[model samples]
Target chain A: MNTLQLDLGERSYPIHIGANLLAQPDLYKKHLKGSLTAVVTNETVAPLYADRVVKTLESLGQKVKLIVLPDGEVFKTWEVLQKIFDGLLECSADRKATLVALGGGVIGDMTGFAAACYMRGIRFIQVPTTLLSQVDSSVGGKTGINHPLGKNMVGAFYQPQAVIADLDTLKTLPPKELAAGLAEVIKHGAIADAEFLTWIENNQNALNACDPKAMEHAVRRSCEIKSQVVAQDEKEGGLRAILNFGHTFGHAIEAGMGYGQWLHGEAVGCGMVLAADLSVRVGLLSEADASRLKKITAALRLPTVPPKLGINRYMELMSVDKKAEGGEVRYILLDGFGRAKIQAVDDALVIQTLQAAGAG
Target chain B: MNTLQLDLGERSYPIHIGANLLAQPDLYKKHLKGSLTAVVTNETVAPLYADRVVKTLESLGQKVKLIVLPDGEVFKTWEVLQKIFDGLLECSADRKATLVALGGGVIGDMTGFAAACYMRGIRFIQVPTTLLSQVDSSVGGKTGINHPLGKNMVGAFYQPQAVIADLDTLKTLPPKELAAGLAEVIKHGAIADAEFLTWIENNQNALNACDPKAMEHAVRRSCEIKSQVVAQDEKEGGLRAILNFGHTFGHAIEAGMGYGQWLHGEAVGCGMVLAADLSVRVGLLSEADASRLKKITAALRLPTVPPKLGINRYMELMSVDKKAEGGEVRYILLDGFGRAKIQAVDDALVIQTLQAAGAG
Candidate 1:
């Protein structure tokens, strides 16, 4: 077992990476505050892990309530959120109760948001099952539902008490989702750690094969990078914006292609390519390093070309991206291979990048 | 003008109590972060004050967008919140843009919650028009929408940059709503300030008449007491529960009678009577003090008798109160005339108090 801590003062919590972690009591039980615990999972994940999770909590004498939401990014809506509320209220779960999110990013985001809003706020644990979630979303306290007009448009920065990433669950994950998760791992390296990027390049075959040792290293390093960034800029005042390196363009792809059409990681994987292209055009990054980043994403079997949504459609969607200010979209471009900076690109330059990076 | 600051470290903000505050650009404009601002008001308040608010911000070179929601407590829902998001997205308002909630408690709460969730978080200002909001909701960072299953079941504790409470807006407030606002004032006095309680008792007629001087004193004093309590316990971990002296029972009243059927203040007024009765039964308060509290609420023309929601219904509703833990309903009752404590009363004892205080 390997552990990494996200130091957030009073809000600090640990992320545990290991196989069969859910079967281990100490990882989750240490964070449990009250006797009442609600396990919020989606339908797909519920059939697989809900029983083990409930059994573990019940063994610790917790009165457990299971709230199973429908699966998918589309289910991440206000109506589904209300269902979580309904379960909490129906079971009379109070402010003292703990909510355990027992699925991937969707469940983690929804449950973290549910905890933030449930009775103003409550304690919750993140048990991220997907690689994407374990590496990124679950670490930073960014939990919210997507607005129809945009992705992750509604949410809160409510941190969890702890994060339990049981690698055993990854065994059941579809290959496509696993590869999608690597997009974020690649992002962490691209934005902050050049050494980690080289390490990823060396271990690409090991990662593609889903070797436990390689997976553990990728997850831990990614979380360490994220935790350091979040500890400094908890609410994205300035430094935290760097973490959204590919997200602005990624969000446009997610919204433009219709949410759920492309997995978040896939969109982000392609978005990073465009951001790199824009970086080279703006003279912020070298053409060699930009292509290296693109080559690595392609090697991971992630999308290297963005879908050709009309430049105007993409512009309309990106205009509503949270990173935009006063209607001008701010792009997070690489200063080099491992450093990121937020800059406003010229409209003409962005259009050129769009034209150059689009799939035929 | 009277000002009180709720000291929450960096999240601290000032509460300005005066007449014609909206016309003063320095009060709000100084806190404005970006050139774009969205003024969120309800229908009832829009025709009355939206133009002045927009003009005030416009005077300071802010490009403003006005979003008018239907006026009423019932309109505080996710669907209406979508309207606020729609307006911001439609105009492409970004993270730096400001959201100014320009109505009573409902508008303040909905807009504050929207600002808290929009793009994960953004800067917002409170321009409270109703006396209820001026004294209570606007000062604290508590903002949310009511769920069908529970009131304030979904929300966040996102503080505003500043709160501008213009007493001048109360001149147009309906008589019934003004009295409802007084209920909170009376509560502040009863729970924390015996002297303020005595003052409310002596000045009932002036308060009932909506005298500007009396209104200013009541609003300022209430905010002072609330700000002090919130500064110590911002998230209600302990001492702050005392602030909800009548809210446990009050939430039941609001949920028992369909929301908006009984104005929040009216229900809280009557709930205080029931809570006082329970406190007397528990031997924490004197019968004489309890009756005195009831007499003042009655004197203000607020309800002294709670509607006859069956004991079972009240118990069912109160069990879901945020104060409750592990299915035990915790009531905030007066320990004497001005002190409060949270304790779990026996269900039978609560039933007895309900039978004694209900309208016959």
Candidate 2:
């Protein structure tokens, strides 16, 4: 078992990664504030791991309630987020009642946000059941629902009590979902660690096969890089903008196609490719480095090309992104491997890159 | 103008209380991050002060968009709150865009919560027009919308950049609303300042007539006491709970009668009366002091009696309150004048108090 602590002062929490940690009841006992606990998951994960978690909480004498929301990124909206509130209120969950998020990024985001808002605020644990969530969403305290205008447009930077990433759950993940998770894993490597990117390129087969050892390193390294950046800038004031390297373009893809059309990591994967192209145009990166990043993304089975959302549509979508300041979309470009920069480029340059990528 | 600072470390902000402060552009300029600013008000306040605020922002070279929501507490729901988001999105408000809450408590809350959640968070200024908002809601960082299940069931504790409490706006306030605002002014005196309570008791005429000097002192002192308590415990971990002196019972009455039926301060006024009765029953206060508090509440023309909701219904309502822990309702009882205590009392005693008040 490997544990990493995300240092956020009083809001800091531990991230537990290992095999079958969900079956270990002790990981949850310390975080439970009261007798009542609500395990919030989606329909898909509920059928698989809900009972194991419920029995574990109940063994410790907790009155556990299972709230199963519909699964998918499309369900990440205020209307659907209200269901979690409804379930909690129906059971009379109080300020001290703990919520355990037991699914992927969508579930973790919604439950964490629900915890942030329920009675002003409450405690919640992130029990991520997917690779994308374990590596990205679980570590950061960013919890929120998306609006029709943009992805993750409404939410809070609320930290969790702890994040339990049970590797055993990844054994059942579909190949496509595994690829989506790899996108973020690649992002961590591309922006912060050059050697890690090389390692990913060399270990494509091991990752695709979901080898326990390789998966563990991937998740750990990804969390380490992401947590360090988050620790420095908890609220995305300045330094944290680097963490949104491909998000400006990624969010456009997600919103332009309507959420759920492309998995978040998938859109982010292709968005990275577009961002690298923009990096080359802006004289920040060599074409060879951009090509290398693209090759690595494609080798992992994630999409390397964005959908044909058109120049105007993509620009419109990106302008509403949270990273945009004063209506000017700021692009997070790769200055070089292991380094990133955020700046606003000319719209003409952005359009040229989009046209080259066939997205214009 | 009288300026008081709420010391919340990095999140600290100034509360400016005086006549015609809203028309002063300098107050808004220092806080605004960018050119775009959204003025969020309700229908009632828009016709009264929206133009003045917008003109002020426009004069400072701000591109202002006015978002008018429906008036009343009933509209303090997520559904109605969405309108603010819609307005912001329609205008392409970016991360640096500022939101000015230009009404009473409802506008301040929804706008503050909107600012808290919009793109994770944004900047907002509170221009409280109502006396109740000027004295209470604008000072604290508590921002949220209500649910069918409870008042403020979902929201965030987001601080505003500044709170502009214009005494001039109170001139247009209705007599009942003025009395409602007095409830909180009276509460600050009862729970934290016995001298202020005595002053309130002696100056009912000036307060009733909305005299500038009396109103200024009332709002300034309330902000001082509330900000001090908030500075010690911003998230209500312990010391801040005392600030909710009558909120537990008050929320029950508001929810029991359906929101918007009784103005929040009116319900709080009556709830304070019930809490005083409970304090007497628990041997925490003398019957004479309790009667004195009730007399002061009634003298301000605020309701001193709770509606007959029956003991069971009141219990049900209070249990779901944010103060409740693990299904047990924690009552904020008066320790004596100018002090408060939180504890779980026997259900039988609560029932007896309710019966005695003719609310059973």
Candidate 3:
């Protein structure tokens, strides 16, 4: 087991990395301080893990209630949030009832959001099931549902009481999803740590083989980088924009294709490739570095190009991305591997990058 | 003008309390740094103040867009919050657009929530008109809306860029609404400063007659007390709950009677009376002190006895209050005016207190 703590003063929370950590009942017991613990999961996760978690919570003298929601990002909406509230009321959970989010990014995001809204705010634990959630979404406490017009359009920067990412759960995730999760792991390297990028490139086979130590290192390093970024810019005031390295274009792709059509990390993976290519065009990144980024991502089986959505539709969709500054579309282009900067690029350049990235 | 600062480091904002502050275009122009500003108001405040504030923002080379929403507390829903997003989208409001909340608490809460959710967050200014908003709601930055099952079920503790509380607007307020707002003003005295309570008691007639100095002192002292409390406990971890001295009972009244049936301040006025009566039952307050609270609230023409809701309905409603911890319905009991403490009394004692308050 490996442990990393995000030092955010009172907002600080610990991230635990290890195999079978979920089976450690103490992790569940420690974070949930209330008498009642509500488990929020999607249809997929509940059948597999909810009972075990509930039994653990019950053994700790806590009453457990389960709210099993529909799976997928498309279900992330105000109506779904309302359902969670209904469950809370029906179960008679109070302000002290701890909400435990138990699934990957979709479930984690929706549950974190549900906890954020439930009773104005309540204690919640993130028990991420997917690799993407374990590496990225589960740790930082940014929770929200998507508005019809935009992705993550309505949410709060609410930190969870604790995060427990059990690597054992990843064994159950599909290969495609695992590849998607690795995209974020690679993102952490490209944006802030060239050494980590090299390490990922060297250990891609081991990571694909589910080597425990290698996987834990990837998760811990990604969390450490994100923790530092989040601590400095908890509310996305400035430095936090770097965390959206591929998200500006990624969100546009996701929204353009409609949510649930592509995995978040997969879209982000393609967006990063295009972003790197654009950086090369703009002279901030070397073609060699861009090639290195692609070779490593390919080893993980993640997509390196956006699906064929026409450039005009893509541009219009991305224009509303929260990452855009002052109505101008921007990208978190790399200055080189391990260094990134936000740049306002012209439409012509973005269209050109799209053409190159989408070219066969 | 009286200025009180919240002192929350970078989140700190000044509460400007005085007559004609909002009418001055310079006040709006000085704080708004960018050219794009969106004034989010409701139907009630649009015809009343939006045009005037828009003219001021426009005069300062700002492109102003008015998002006029439907009025009422019940309208403070996610649906309405989405409308603000829609309006921003319609206006093509980029990150540079500053949201100016130009109305009472509902508008401020909704606008702040929208800003907090818009692109993760945007700069917002609170132009609080009602005394309830000016003295308490505007300063705290606890922005959210009610749920069908619970009040303020979803929200965030988002601070504003600035707060402009113009006292002159109170002149046109309906007598009932104005008196209701004074409930919060009186509450600050009861929870934080005995001297302020005495001052309010001594200047009852002058305050009723709209003495500018009395209003100034009332607003400043109230803001200062709240500022100190909020500084210590940004979230309701501890001291901030003292600010809810009357809120537990007030929330029950609002929920029991259905939201908007009784104005928020009116319910809080009654809640304060019930809470004071509860204090006597719990052995923290003397009967004499309790009577004085009723007298003071009555002097301000605020409701003293909580409205008749059957004991069962009150219990059902109060149990769901965000303050209820571990199924224990705790009330903020007052030892006397300007001194309050949270206490868990037996259900029997709560019933007796309500009966006594209703009779008194």
TM-score (0 to 1) of chain B for each candidate: 0.98, 0.99, 0.96
Docking class of 2: high
> What is the per-residue lDDT of model 3 for residues B265-304, given as tens digits with 9 covering 90 to 100?
9999988988888888888889898888889999999888
- The better-scoring model by TM-score among 1 and 3 is 1
Badly placed stretches (over 4 Å) of model 2 are none
Worst 10 contiguous positions by lDDT, candidate 1 chain B:
B351-360
The C-alpha lDDT values of all candidates are 0.90, 0.92, 0.84
Which residues of candidate 3, in runs, are more than 4 Å off?
A: A202-206, A209-214, B211-213, B357-360
Q: DockQ of every model listed?
A: 0.83, 0.86, 0.58
What's each prediction's clash count? 0, 0, 1
Query: Compared with the true structure, what per-residue lDDT tens digits does model 2 show for residues B41-124?
Result: 988999999999999999999999999999999999998999999999998888889999999999999999999999889999
Question: Model 1: what TM-score?
Answer: 0.98
Question: Considering every candidate listed, which one attains the maximal TM-score?
Answer: 2
Residue A153 error, candidate 2, Å = 0.3
Whole-model alpha-carbon lDDT for candidate 1: 0.90
lDDT of 2 at B151: 90
On residues B28-129, what C-alpha lDDT tens digit does candidate 1 reach at each position? 877999898999998899999999999999999999999999988898998999999999888877888899999999999999999999988889999999
* Each prediction's RMSD to truth: 1.5, 1.2, 2.4
